[model samples]
Target: MTATRQLEGKIAWITGGGSGIGAATARALAEAGAHAVVSGRRAAELDRVAADIRAQGGQADTLPLDVADAGAVADAGAQIAATHGAVDILVASAGINVPNRAFAELDTASWDRIVAVNLSGVMYAVSAVLPGMRTAGDGLVVIVSSWVGRHAVKLGGPAYNATKHGLVALGHSLNMEECANGIRACVVMPGEVATDILAKRAAPPPPEELARLLDPSDVARMIRAVCEMPARACVNEILISPAWNRNFIAPGEAAPRPARAAT
Candidate 1:
C-alpha cells in the first residue's frame, strides 16, 4: 500500500481532536485515507480541524464532546457508528493538568476533575468503541499517556501522574483481554510536548525550552505509524521524548515551585 493511503477505508475517532497531538493525529490519519472523526469540548476548534482536513481533500467530521461526560461520549460513539460505520481506530488523547500540581497544593476538587478527564474519561471512550471493534474483529486503540505515566515525576502533580499511570495499565489490560479478538492497544508515553497544556503549568517553559520539547506532529507521526501496522502485529507501548528531556534535569531544579500561601 502507498504510504499516503495506508489507512484508506478506515474510520478513526480521536478524542481531544480540537488541538495539540489529537489535532495533528487527525490530519495525519486523514492524509493516509482514513475518515477522521474529531471530537472535543470546543465545538469551534473541532470544526476548524475538520475544515482544514476537508480543505486538504480528505474525509473529515466533527463531534463536539466532553470526554469526561460518559453519556455524551457514548452517544457520540453511537452516532459515529450509525453514520460512518465501525470506528477502525480510536485515539484517546483527552487529558488535563492544573497549575496546583504539587501535592501540597493539590485539592480534592482538582484531583477529581483531573481523574475524570484523564483517567475515567479514557475508560469511557475506550468502552464506547470496543463493541464495534469486537464485531469487526479488527481494531487499534492508541492511548496518549505521558512519560510521567511510566516514571513518576513531581512536575506532573499527583492527580495528573496517577491518571497517566493508570493509562499504561489500562492499555495493557485491553491487549491481554482483547488480543484474541484481534484488537490491539498501544499506550504512547511522551515527554514534554509543546502544547497548550503547558500554559496550565505553574511555570510555563520559556521559548528556548519549548524549542527543545517535542512537537504535537512528532507524536502524531508515531501514532499514524502504529495505525498502519498489520493486524497480526501489535505495538503495546511507545516511549518517545525529545533529545533534551527535562526529566533528566536535577530533581529540585526541575520541579515547579509551590504556590505561595495566601495572606
Candidate 2:
C-alpha cells in the first residue's frame, strides 16, 4: 500500500493537538488516512484543528481536557478507545515550560506544575492507552520531547530540563518493554521551534531569530515518516532542527547571519 493508505482506518490520539507540533501532526496523520482524535485544554483550538482536518476531506475529532489531570487523561483515553476503537497511534505532545529561572529562584509551585504536566501527564496518557495496544498486539507512540531533554541549559530551567529528560527515559523504557507486543515508541528531541510556546519564555526571542527556528510542520512530517515505516522496523529516537543552529545561543543575544546571494 502507498503511504497515503498506510494508516487507513487507524485511530490516532494526540495530546496538545490544538496547536504547534500537536496540531501539525494531527493534520499530517489525518492526511495519511487515520482518524485523528485531538485532545487539549482549549476547546476552541481543538475544534479548529478538527474542522481543518474535516475541511481537507480527512477524519478528525476533538476532546478538550487538561493532560495534567491524571484522572481526566485516563478517562479520556478509555472513553476514546471505547467509542472509536483502540488508538493505533498515541502522540503525547502536551507539555509546558515556565519562564526560565535560576535554581535558587525556582519556586515549588512552578516546579510542581511542570512535573505534573510534563512527566505525570505523559505517564498517565501512556498507561491509559497501553492496555488496548497490548491486547491488540500493535501500536505506535510518539513522544515530543525537546533538545533540552538530553542536555542541561540555562534557558530551559531546572523544571523544564528535568521533565524533558524524564520523557526521553520514559520513551526508551516503553519501547524496550512493549516491542515484544508489537508496540513501537519514539522520542523526538527537537531544537527551538517557532511556536506559541516561545511566548512563555522568560525572554521571547526577536522575530528574526524566531524565524530561523524550525517550523512545527517539519516535526510533524517526521512523525508521519515514523508512522509510515513498516511494522517490522521501529524508530527509537529522532533529533530534528533547522539548518541554521541557533539553539546554542541565548535568545536575543545572537544576531542573524546575513543571507547569501544566489550563485
lDDT of 2 at 64: 91
lDDT per residue (tens digit) for residues 27-126 in model 1: 9999999999999999999999999999888999999989999999999999999999999999999999999888799999999999999999999999
Weakest 10 consecutive residues of candidate 1 by summed lDDT = 248-257
- Give the local distance difference test score of model 2: 0.90
Q: Which ranges of candidate 1 are over 4 A from the true structure?
A: 1-3, 250-263
Q: Model 1 clash pairs?
A: none
List candidate 2 segments past 4 Å from native.
Answer: 1-3, 249-263
- Supply the TM-score for candidate 2: 0.93
TM-score per model over all chains: 0.94, 0.93
Q: Please write out the lDDT profile of model 2 over residues 1-263, one tens digit for every residue.
A: 13465789899999999999999999999999999999999999999999999988899999899999999998999899889989899999998887755698789998999999899999999999999999999999999999888766678888999999999999999988999999999999998889999999878977887888999999999999999998888899998877776756554566656899899
